[model samples]
Target: MTRQLRRPPETQDLSRESPTVSVVLLSYNRPDYLRQAVASIRAQSYRSIELIVVDNPSPSSAEIAETVAAQGNVRLIRSSVNSGYAGGMNRGIESAAGRYIYLTEDDIVLDKDCIRHLVEYAKERQSGGLVSPVMYNKTEGTIRCAGGEFALGAVYRRRTHGEGERDTGQFARPFNVTYIDGATMFARADLFRRLGGFREEYFMYVEAVEFCARALKAEQTLTVIPRARVYHFEPPADANASANF
Candidate 1:
């Protein structure tokens, strides 16, 4: 109708310039945070991505749908029960239709070039199945992590921590980290399938570690590219505590 035709073009960048990347952003009850997460993806420099927001049983899919209705190429999938991060994200991965699958959470705000740079870095590395960007917490004004390497046996440090430490490009160079945090990482769709996705046993914590271990077991490389970045927000109270998210 003429009225519908009079509507102006939306400011949201829903253009699917490249269909190679599929972002699987898992969400729970945090609708506000989820809104920001989806907006970040919509603002990405890389335009060839399809965003699949796998809602962990959002009570009102209609409300969530209305939130993202204007964002092109965005799909919302909901689970019947509360599936934790592992299970929820696994469902997202299974339904992804891109060559590169990106995993992220509702609290993370990705830099515009995060996906572009990550994909480019992975392409250059060729062998790496997983790639992560440097994570920063704006509220704390500190580096959450650069990337992590395994410690003695099963335990491993999460790279950088401490108020005294600085992230002034000291660990800026990309390196072969032992593993990448799944909160905001890119994985090859085929490789993700080959690894059988995240082990549902993990539920929430250790999902990334378990996935990386399986990838390594099957001879897949994991790397980090400082060029790519994402802003990860954490509560002031839970800033230092490793909460089982």
Candidate 2:
């Protein structure tokens, strides 16, 4: 407790100071999912944001470009070569122009106030490197991942409480978490640049965990805001990626 209060103050600014955010969505061959994802961004209550969709080496990605063009503030980039997840995200971040940058998968659907809540939380913690919401499985309505814990050999992402479980009194508290799910994450642009972007080495698995380790090692906090919520489209029997882990 004393140690927490003794932490140094951060110098970064996180006000609604500006509503601009460059939201990046990286996709491969999932055009249908991309459409819904782009639409979710377009529907954000925070209107000053722009959308960047990176279509990585898909034969039909051009059609995604055409579809995104219909929306005024969207910028679509189709990569000639497949850069996988990390590379595609890097390309999108390079092109993003906003004080804050957000990343999400093409299958997510955001609530209108999603960005609003994230921005507000970030503002409260000026040096926060990453912030995310409590995510529920879109299909099952079960909690997916709220935040994570780094211990032993790997980080563990915790899911929701079991049915009929009583709400604890700690529900209102906002605390530092080990890492946020990359499915929906927000960060200040400068902090992101300082972190050197997501590591492209791991390809898919453990990217967020690695990034969180780096951020926490630097004394930057990763927070979870319960008020900000989203639904993750994880199919019931969807198994974790094998080789990526």
Candidate 3:
């Protein structure tokens, strides 16, 4: 999951059909990172995607609005309150108009082909639903996780693989994962609506996991597409929310 080029993709052919892909980028107070996230989406090779920036209401709401205004085709939704990641994403999902909904943090910088590859892979799957890409730590240039897992019994330690490894293709092959990092997730819009989006009660942490848990109950598959990649930058001290860290 390191942020280096892992050989050129054999095909740049994004998707046979250009279905609208909506990206719900959640940002609380990090304006600079928000701009980077929006710009990265705008720079994507796939042109059919729409960007929905859900800004948790804060003192910097006006500044965030101004920054999002500069980016064409991106819709800015200002929350009346700082309704955590769960609420923000639910609102964004409501506004999304794509066949696929991609969840991302404001601190992430996606590869140009990230959306393209994701949509292509989604169309390729027979019954897959939630899918995510390999997340690389921006500055450290190391693996964050191929996908996430949880240990049973006492601690229930949440684990992610290839934490500090180089981009050597050790965990390169695509596989089914327990949970995908909330930083970047792509799924079908129909399935998301059917699943009722993220539970607004959880607020931030464990919301995605809870959503995936329900998906499992419904017998849906969560997958990882190794070819799709994204750069997850270091987050603010508070982890997106004002004081949720």
Candidate 4:
């Protein structure tokens, strides 16, 4: 059910005076992971924040709704059909009422200061159109993506920086990047809305790549803030599934 749960007592007095960060968390069938992700967002150090959970017609929709209702302070958007990553996120983005929008997946567990650090960096780097935190594998304790770049050739290819590398202060500094991973993206609300959000035609994969490409074409900078961190609990690849490429 699409509904806005009552705000928690602590946030009842949240006013529009401060810049608000709207976190658009997309949930598929991973209800357990969604719970963890919501908890982490609730624990964020950034006080001016709103959590919008978009359920993309998961089989476990009832359970997902139950989990969100338990929070009693989040906005949940339930889609009738599974619209994939881009479409689901776009729904949440449309309902966002913040100055900044953060898009993340259910499998992500963010650090308490992740949003705070991202906002700080974005404020300092006003040119940044998209900013993201360094992501590490929750299980293996290795870098998943610090930032990423597109290696366009015969076909489009994505190269994630520091993927599978042990995090040992290598990507410790913030720097410019071609694109921020879709797992976690912090963007100015105006720019994201102006770009019409992600292209729904991509459905799931490569949507972030195309969106970043468009942003770059507009001369906007994309960056990765290393001080902010998130752990990605990526599911194992399907061995039986065929690779078309």
Candidate 5:
């Protein structure tokens, strides 16, 4: 089951804008972080954006709806079941009307110019299929993920670049990468729709990796624009979590 909160009348004018960027923010059981993330997106230097909030059956569903309602120009989609990250993102993407889609998680805050930088870079590099910003740990101020690639092996493994390093301008230059972190991804709307969004069978983990791999196989270039940055408030790993999938 799914419910959609209507957007305010004032937000209707957003469709008139050319080349609008739709931001699909996936939230699950974290209302406070959702508020902060929404605030950061609203504060972006790029103003032509439409925000879509997908609540993945959060326990705080009412609070999530309230937060989204308080922020005008936001469309809220509430799911009856927790479909994990991939499904939630797909829901938002299906309703997106922008030429560009910016997929993000609830606990990350974007830099004011983050979207602007991404849009500019994407336009400059027409062949780039996916572009993502450099992510830093919000509390630790250390690199979370600059960009990443898979290790050549029979099993799936990833090698993240500059995972725990300080901002020393080493990964500052924009370059091609094997995959972009799922926390914050920017790409053309058509590309995502054409690829049928993410494979929901995996539920949460490795969806981004598989999506990127498919995109690469389709001859799309994945890249990281280091100038654009986002701060991620990543939670501690669950002790019970396993890689059995």
Candidate 6:
């Protein structure tokens, strides 16, 4: 009888060495928008990410959560009452269990490297409490937010850059910034908990700005990483996107 080749021992278990990152998104009644957002997230280059989607008591949101959950790496949370942006995000953030937590919108489409780039930038900076990227408007192909600065009077925290190509170089470099739109924000979980998350009183607008301001007051560094850009899918062309916000 021919000698049988020795077989290698079978491995019993396998585990990933990298830490997990949690992406928390808040959704209302926009099921279609949630689908697009989930699709983009499922295509991320990073494999160790947990997606947490919180529905703010929308009548049709259960279906949205089901559809998103089908894609894997997703957790759905539904509220009994319609909590606005701040309240919903608070719930999502509390459920996230990753070293880094990404606060984002259900209507945005992310680039493949968006999360990876943000994590890398945060690691390199070593002191960034919050990091956000340049956001582009899907409808007009224009720049939405790229490092805002506050000025005196009406120009305070104004977005000075022009639309489209005119705002190209504004985000070419990374530095400490005044405010980052909550539409896409990556923050260290530890730091986030320490800060107690967003001030829920704002309800909607200005909450993000207030968070950054508080972070600054506490001497926590907030940086804008230019390499990671995301598409902010605002209102369609048929509607007045400006008034919608």
**TM per prediction:** 0.82, 0.81, 0.87, 0.88, 0.88, 0.83
Off by over 4 Å in 3: 1-16, 151-156, 235-242
The 10 consecutive residues of candidate 4 with the worst lDDT sum are: 236-245
lDDT of 4 by residue, 163-184 (tens): 9999889876889888688878
Alpha-carbon lDDT of model 4: 0.80
Residue pair clashes in candidate 6:
150-157
**What number of backbone clashes does candidate 6 have, counting pairs of residues 3 or more apart or in separate chains?**
1
RMSD, model 1, all Cα superposed?
9.1
- What local lDDT does model 5 show for residue 199? 77
Off by over 4 Å in 2: 1-16, 152-172, 236-245
What are the per-residue Cα lDDT tens digits for candidate 5 across 121-207? Answer: 887767459999999998999999988888433115888888989998998589988878877788987788777778787676678
Candidate 4 clashes between residue pairs 3 or more apart in a chain or in different chains:
none
Task: Tell me the tens digit of each residue's lDDT in model 1 across 45-125.
Answer: 987887998876655456666776766678888877766888888788777777788999878889999999987776666
lDDT of 3 by residue, 50-138 (tens): 78899988766788899999887788888888778888888887777777789997888999999988888887765457898898888
The per-model lDDT (C-alpha) reads 0.72, 0.69, 0.77, 0.80, 0.81, 0.72
- Model 1 scores worst on lDDT over the 10 consecutive residues at 1-10
C-alpha lDDT of residue 80 in model 6: 79
Q: Which 10 successive residues of model 6 have the least lDDT summed?
A: 1-10
Candidate 4 TM-score versus the reference: 0.88
User: Which residues of candidate 4, in runs, are more than 4 Å off?
Assistant: 1-17, 151-155, 236-245
Candidate 5: global Cα-lDDT? 0.81
| Clash number by candidate, in order | 1, 0, 0, 0, 0, 1
